[model samples]
Target: MKDDDKAVYLGTDCGATTSKVGAVWGDGTVVSTKLLQRVTRSQDGPAAVVASWVDAASDFLSQHDLTWDQVHGAGLAIPGPYQRYGVLDKSPNLPDTFTGFDVHNAYAGALADRAGRPIPLVVGNDGNLGGVGEAQHVRGRGHGTVLLLAPGSGLGCAFVDERGLPLDGDTLAGMEGGHVPIPLHLLGAKPYPCGCGRTWGCVEVYTTLSGLPYLLEERLEKYPDHELAKSGKPMKERAFALRTLAQNGDPLALEIFDFQAKALGIHVAVMAMAVDPRYVVIGGGLMDPEATSDAFRERYLGVVRDTALPLLWPAQRTTLTIVPASLGDLSQSIGAALVALYRSRS
Candidate 1:
């Protein structure tokens, strides 16, 4: 699709941190240059989140002198795990009212009010949409299994089949990759307790922003004389300082950061081995280049390169490339737009 010839669809990625919007045309031209900080899922209700989206859309259209009718369709991507037909099953990061909420109907109502008719609305999991966008846009029409990992409040994984089709449709078995058990035996460390209330250990329990503090605090005995505890500050600030120190090659800080990197790398390696993806696209809060350094990046990639399986296990040989998400945080919006475009065609 060419930029001018493509359908003009609107997409909103309603993230816990921010909402990103974009316009995709039929001619393959994408103009994604706007963002709104999240105001939903606070002490307020889930309806507040839907209302905020409408308000943001109105503001965006007003600024550009674009009418609601100009939008061919609208897509909204929310964090998962989604229930049957685009309902949120349980979004731990959001308000409790959002659990099992009818996201599609909520969005349709909002758009109908603004446009005088319900603009076609499609909803999807943010990670799923992001992977779809990356595979379609950035990867340029290749055919192979691919994995998209977004390490934010929790670690999320989205896998696309070799045919370039995502596996969320009815009748397909669910793919909750993050909830899969982590092999702590490989790391020689005590298994970290998971929020899932399972002591068996899941990958997200140790790899996410929520998990970072616990990992660092557990290792605090090694750095009691370090600045974080000594200053009576919070763990996150200390983690940042430790990250800086690691960047500067301080021994203790380097050790802690390496543990995190290694843990993440191990999960990636396991995912790659399981899916045999040709490429792995990484995004989310932790993927911010500011939070990690090139050396740390290499440490994460190294685990994939050095990973080995048991002799009896069929060792899969495949070339896997690791790269940053092309859209960064904007992926969900772009993906949502893509989904709307797909639905409109159907």
Candidate 2:
């Protein structure tokens, strides 16, 4: 292939437990992809983790019968509280070793050294990139502004404008939607401690899997005959088991999902009021069909539509469309690649 036609970009999506690496063409077609588990061990330190990322990227190119010279640039999507420069201020899910680590420079330096040339790179929050990916998917389909919610080890949020570009600008400023506080009255009597070390309730604590244990305990107390409670499994195991039961039509499991859906709906409503987005895309394993079933999507959207309608007040609730992510779990990786393609061309 000619150099111009063969040109590709590298992208990485770094999560709490795993990292996804991929290479893609400028047209959004993925050339290669891989998942690296436990890539961010605290003992390994930030530099080591960053090295692993570079290794992954190089491996991806080799697997595709390409060379670093064909790579135009690289982009990264990471769980954050990070600056635009890719310096992690602090990550609740990441090891303490990553605090204040300049991940961008580390990856850029390592990759550049391997390629024997300078490489341009960009970094963004994983959730924000997911939003960008989804927004790009539906850009011309009548969706202008897009809001994305990622419920997983923690809750994540991001916004995109009419052109499917992130609204946070080059610095990625003001995109920390997960840390948005939830009213105490909205939460149950017990405190919902966030993974961010905050004792107070936040949207993440009540909407994601990590927070489901608290709600499960509340439900078990109310329904002593619940199958999950009878199993006596640990909190994490019980959470997964409950998802299975819910998919099987267990009443208690369904009830727990309803409670979670309500909380998520309320939060979405608040965000919609603020951003007035045309579409709200919910992503993450929690929303996948295998975890809870399509019914979870229906229930969650129903609550969002119903709750947000009155708040919108004469703006016509139909203006908003709440839906699941179109790109599914691959959104972040694709988005990171999109960022690289855009930045490299600029």
- Among all candidates shown, the one with the greatest lDDT: 2
Clash totals for all candidate models? 8, 0
Q: Report lDDT (CA) for all predictions.
A: 0.68, 0.75
Model 1, 14-101: lDDT tens per residue? 7775677766765435655555345554457678878888887777677666677677788887776666676886665676788878
lDDT of 2 by residue, 194-308 (tens): 8888886777877788888888887788878766778767876788776777777788877876776667777787787678888888788766665556776677667655655
TM-score of 1: 0.85
Model 2 misplacement above 4 A: 32-43, 141-143, 169-173, 184-190, 231-233, 290-292
**How does candidate 2 fare on TM-score?**
0.88
